[model samples]
Target: MTAALCLFLAAINIATLLAFWWDKDAARAARRRIPERNLLALALFGGTPAAFAARQMFRHKTRKQPFSTYLMVIAAAQAGGALGLALA
Candidate 1:
């Protein structure tokens, strides 16, 4: 990936991570939670790396059944694309 692409990905990841953190805080306070769709949208938009890191670090949403499954699928797809690029 080019430097610009790397930076873009990094920004996405950071945004997603912070969003996750905010959601966690919101959950604790019984506030309006960030919608799952929004989180998945961020992941699909190339934030999977940061999303996974945030999930692991915050221990948030790790136990959510279908959400975990969806995240796995996103991660798999991203990894596959990266591998294809490397092999090309």
Candidate 2:
């Protein structure tokens, strides 16, 4: 189960990395078009790390007010979750 979860996370992370790497501008623009609820669903379903990583790497949505703060918090939580999963 853990291995599957890790694989899933890795896949998502890689996808996000590729998306950001290919065309950061397009990714940022695509993000704007997506609903916040959809993004939140992705984050909640273990994609937070990828989303946060993409935000940092692509410099997308990092300058806003509440969204920036929320993303930071979510990133921290995701790190904590990953650490806990590893330790368990």
Evaluate all candidate structures by whole-model CA lDDT and list the values in order: 0.93, 0.66
As a TM-score, model 1 comes out at 0.92
TM-score of every prediction relative to native: 0.92, 0.57
lDDT of 1 at 64: 98
Where does the lowest 10-residue lDDT sum fall in candidate 2? Answer: 31-40
Q: CA lDDT of 42 in candidate 1?
A: 97
User: Tens digits of per-residue lDDT for model 2 on 9-83?
Assistant: 787767655554555665556644544455545666667767777778778666767766776677788779869
Q: List all candidate RMSDs to the true structure.
A: 1.1, 4.0
For model 1, residues 15-49, the per-residue Cα lDDT tens digits are: 99999999999999999999998999999999998
Alpha carbon lDDT of residue 46, candidate 2?
A: 67
Instruction: Write down the lDDT that model 2 would get.
Output: 0.66
